[model samples]
Target: MKTKKPTQSAKQAAVRYLSRRDHAEQELQQKLLARGFEQEEVDEAVALCQDYNWLDDARFAERLLNNGIAKGWGLLRIRQEMAHKGIHEEVVSHLFEDDEFDWFEHAREIAQRKYGDSPMDTDKEKARRLRFMQSKGFDFEQVKYALDVDDDEY
Candidate 1:
């Protein structure tokens, strides 16, 4: 009996990748490379996914942004995460455009729930909260607004 070699076409690999999870084209290409596929093979696989509209950067960015925002992340954090996920700059820009107010409201609500109606009076405590906000991906302005503290004060 003769054993048949795996017909490892790019489309087949792309289908496998999509079956596992949604992926940006660049991300899928990187994964394919890491899995021992050659550059040409990875490129072809990415093209296949794109042709099928199964791996779109814009769609990935939208989904990623929605998921992160729903989890209470600020714009800065969401942008960074989307960049890390290999989304193009244009896509990131589109997602964040005209979203400042929405993101601010989200940050404010998160801060209010986490802290309280009253602002922290102590400098050290306020500083700590500011740092925490930064770590959570908020810009200084958003953090100040959310915490209801002045820039000079916080």
Candidate 2:
């Protein structure tokens, strides 16, 4: 049995990696390394894909943000996720600048969907829901407006 050549192995690995889903260069490199590919081979594979426009950090960030937005995630959560995925601060900042990334509206919609028309009668449940909203990455103002609880309720 003959061993596969390094270049052929890298190309095969890259193709297998890309077959699963779209990946940024960094992500692809990490996957290749984890799969036991040598550094030089991984680098070559990443470079080749980049040359062909198959891997792009900016495009990856944009697609991730779009998918997150479609799933109703707030700006804060999305930003955290982007950072975790190795997306640069500048790209994340630009996405946050768009008004369509409003967390307040998302919070309102979420609150309404979970607990419609102020069904909670006691302070404990309100507090629980408030905590839930905060945990969901909503600010106090947004949660208050979303829950529609009067000041006296607190």
Top candidate, metric TM-score: 1
Q: What TM-score number comes out for model 1?
A: 0.86
Best by lDDT: 1
Q: In candidate 1, which residue pairs get closer than 3 Å at backbone N, Cα or C atoms, i.e. clash?
A: none
How far in Å is the alpha carbon of 147 misplaced in model 2? 1.6
Instruction: State each model's CA lDDT, in order.
Output: 0.79, 0.77
Q: Can you tell me which runs of candidate 1 are displaced by over 4 Å?
A: 1-9, 98-101
- Which residue runs of candidate 2 sit more than 4 Å off their true CA positions? 1-8, 150-154
For residues 4-119, write the lDDT of model 1, one tens digit per residue: 43467656877898998788877888777666667887787787778889888988888888888777788788888888988889888886676645667787888887788676
- Model 2 per-residue lDDT tens digits across residues 47-148: 888788777777888888788767656566767778877777887677566646566777899888788886787889989999988776677888888888
